[model samples]
Target: VKPTTPRGQLPLLKIDGKQYTQSLAMQRYAAKKAGFYPTDDIDALVCDECCDTLEEFLLKFPFAAKDEEEKKAKRAEFVKGPMTEISKFIEQKIQDAGGKGFVASGPSVADIMLMVNVKSVESGFMDYINTDFYTNYPGITAVTTAMKEHPKVKAYYDSLN
Candidate 1:
């Protein structure tokens, strides 16, 4: 699959003998096909923006930090600084959309991305980060909780374990 992908990425999607690359593009396509993507133009815009913003944050992280110690320091600084502001914005977006809504309408590609990133922090994927990252933000916690308890998500994770 990686060899067939244009960029040698793991998430290339093949359908009807056609291949689609880019994880975000595939995620969006899946969300749409699963009927989770918002139908309203503004809602779709919000979902897209949230998803892009979250992806950008992950991309901007100092994953290439020179040493383990430096990586830990960089991750800590990032979570305390820009990540704080991003969290605030996410909290606001959730509230603006209604407290229970994830991203635009409900569980969306944006929500899935957010949930996975949150889990990464919690699961020690980032050495210096922990589940406490979202402790101060109820809205973010709620979203992750919803995603975790979601039937399909839960079933997939259960299968993994």
Candidate 2:
């Protein structure tokens, strides 16, 4: 998402702009640009659900206990089950939309959204998550593999340190 002049388009001139202040707003614009806007009201509801699910898990990640003995056994359960299930279900929906492996006839914002979402899980979900969850749903995975190879995405990921 571009931070812009007050007109919201330009050779962007705003420094310390609202766009710089709002990560959520930036991501929404990016998702929209990629064509991932929800298709219908129900899908919109689904999108919100998925977003909430991720935030809930993230809320606990920063404080996640460092050792098996350091954290209660149950403290980590909710994050894993719900987060993993939602991702798997969403992956199913992409397939159900069409098995050919795209959310629409061509690439859409949903592909990018899912790619980033799944990558977060790969980094955060400490348990042994087999990428096979994606294999059965190759459409979603294809987008992910391509995104991983993309120059910009690859650069951003490499800069994660």
Compute each candidate's TM-score over C-alphas.
Answer: 0.89, 0.52
Tens digits of lDDT, candidate 2, 20-65: 3344456556666555556566655555554555455456443456
* Candidate of highest TM-score: 1
Number of residue pairs clashing in candidate 1, backbone atoms closer than 3 angstroms, sequence gap of 3 or more or interchain: 0
The local lDDT score (0 to 100) that residue 133 gets in candidate 2 is: 46
- Local lDDT at 132 for model 1: 81
Q: Can you tell me which runs of candidate 2 are displaced by over 4 Å?
A: 1-21, 32-63, 70-80, 99-102, 121-140, 150-161
lDDT of 1 by residue, 26-53 (tens): 8888889877688988889999988988
Cα RMSD (angstroms) for every candidate in the order listed: 1.9, 7.1
TM-score, prediction 1: 0.89
Tell me the spans in candidate 1 whose CA falls farther than 4 Å from its real position: 1-4, 7-10
Worst 10 residues of 1 by lDDT: 98-107
